[model samples]
Structure formats: C-alpha cells, structure tokens
Target: MARPAVRRGAALGLGMLWWWAVLRLAFAPGAGVLEAAVAAGGWGLSVLPVHCVPRAQAAGAVGPERWRGAWRAVRTTTASPLRRSDAGSGPW
Candidate 1:
C-alpha cells in the first residue's frame, strides 16, 4: 500500500544521505586517521567471507567459533604479559 511505499522511500533517502556523509568525510582534510579507521573498521560489516567458508555437517562452518577461541587465547596471553618491577619505583 501507500504506507509501504512511503517507508521504502524514506529508507532509500536515508541510505543516500548516510552514504553522502561518509563519502564527504572520507574526502575531507584533517579527517585522515579517524576517517581511515572508520572505513577499515566498517569492512567487518560485510559477511561474505564468513558465508564463503565451507560447511561440514550442515550450513555454516565452525571456523567462526574457532576464530573466537583463538582471539580469546591471544588476548589472555597479551593482556598482562609484561610486569612492572617495583623494586625502587617512585610513587606513580
């Protein structure tokens, strides 16, 4: 109905506006590190890579879980790896 059409139009307009804002910032000066980081981080928005993983028993691979576990292990090791010596340290 007309309601659905209105909703679709609003969504399209909002999407275009969002895209414009991102592109503008992407090309703006003094927006180097911050803009580049935002773009790079947005790369995870695409799930095509996850879908590309082959399935074993059913759909979807177990790789994502394994990947998560690996990340946790890495975090645990790196979180407090280096210790500060307090032999004769000043009040910090």
Candidate 2:
C-alpha cells in the first residue's frame, strides 16, 4: 500500500540523514577516536526513546507502564555486556 511505501521512504530518509550526520561528526576537525565513539554512543542513546516509545505503545502499554517498559528495554540492552558471565571476559 501507499502508506507502507511512504513509511519506508521516510525511514530511509531518516537513516540517510543520520548516516550523514555521523560521518560529518566523525570527520570533523580535531575529532579523534574517543570523540567519534562518544558522539555515536550519544546518538544511539538519544534515539532509544524514539524506538522504545513506539514499541511500548504497540504493545498496549500506557503512561507509566510505557515508560517503564522503555526503561527496562534500555537497561537490559545497555547492561547485556556487563551481565555476561563468561570467564576471562573483560570490558572489551
């Protein structure tokens, strides 16, 4: 349907914009590895709420429940590496 096509187009457009922004920041003057990594991480964190809110709403969550679900999702995702129990597995 046209609606689906439009949604896909919008998603692609946003993705391209995000890619361009990341590239610009990564290559900016005086930007090093740490700066690039921090920028990328911050961008990812900022987008998390956008993704989480929609998913929570789709699941029929409301108000505080929606936010709680989002927070839980974020916490689990970010804590996954730290929660790993494998031996000799450092923060790397």
Best by TM-score: 2
Colliding pairs, model 1? none
How would you encode candidate 1's per-residue C-alpha lDDT over 1-92 as one tens digit per residue? 99999999986875565565568676766556555555555554543465443366556556678988987777433464544685556466
Across 45-65, the per-residue lDDT of candidate 2 in tens digits comes to 667755454644576656787
Residue 89 alpha-carbon offset, candidate 2, angstroms? 41
Top lDDT hit: 2
Model 1, C-alpha of 64: deviation from truth (Å): 31
Count of backbone collisions in candidate 1: 0
User: Candidate 2, clashing residue pairs?
Assistant: none
TM-score of each: 0.33, 0.36
